[model samples]
Target: MLSWLAEQRIQEAMRNGEFADLPGHGKPLELEDLSGVPEELRMSFKIMKNAGILPEELTLRAECVTLEELLAACRNSGNANSSEQKSLESKLSLKRLRLQQLLRERGLENSSIFTEYGDQIRQRLSGQE
Candidate 1:
């Protein structure tokens, strides 16, 4: 069989020291920890990660976080402009809605995406002491 031939060839190479000068010859193979990823999409996720492309949910979530931070800063600043704060808040709300829709499509409709971000914006704004 092909595997047997491959094993024979590999043994012959080892006896001939073909692997001696290879990098990391004596070290353990560094295995990737992929326990968290679903079995079917692991390869796709790996390919996307290697190509520096984030999933839509992650990208949207990051935008939401940035908008939230900007809104918070605008509120805290003494000379905060109302128009800019309103625009940032609008953007944040839209992004959150998009993220929620994505979660729903992914069958996570019952779970709150904003919960990952802790208190909602209204709670933070109204509960300020």
Candidate 2:
């Protein structure tokens, strides 16, 4: 009964052009790739994403990537200031350490598959891949 009423309302809104000017109205929706997330936790992950909250590990990983990019740019620049390069490198190292610690806490560090692909994971996270 409730669904029928909700659908009726939606249909009425469509007829009234209430949805016509909504963002991305004519375009295909950009779906998030949640294949890597476990099925049981997918809903929680989606809710957090919609709320603009990122998992801690992801935040740390992103920081590491940004720091690495900054470090690379510093190295490639004409000035090549040693102090600035060192600071960025230090921050990157800290972020990577925190990420590793988080993975270890989650028991992901010792998994056989993770062990095998650890280098690849690191490379990808560091934006090398």
- Each model's TM-score, in the order given? 0.58, 0.67
Full-model lDDT for every candidate: 0.74, 0.78
Stretches of model 2 off by over 4 angstroms after superposition: 1-23, 111-129
Can you write out model 1's per-residue Cα lDDT over 1-129, one digit (the tens) per residue? 999999999999999999999999899998876554456657986899889997787677667767887888998999999999999989988998998898789765464543432234334344442
The pairs that clash in candidate 1 are none
Give the winner by TM-score: 2
Candidate 1's clash total is 0
Candidate topping lDDT: 2
Candidate 1: where are CA atoms >4 Å away?
1-41, 110-129
Per-residue lDDT of candidate 2, residues 1-129 (tens digit):
999999999999999999999999999999876665656657986898899998787677667767877888998899999988888888888888898899889877766554444455457777577
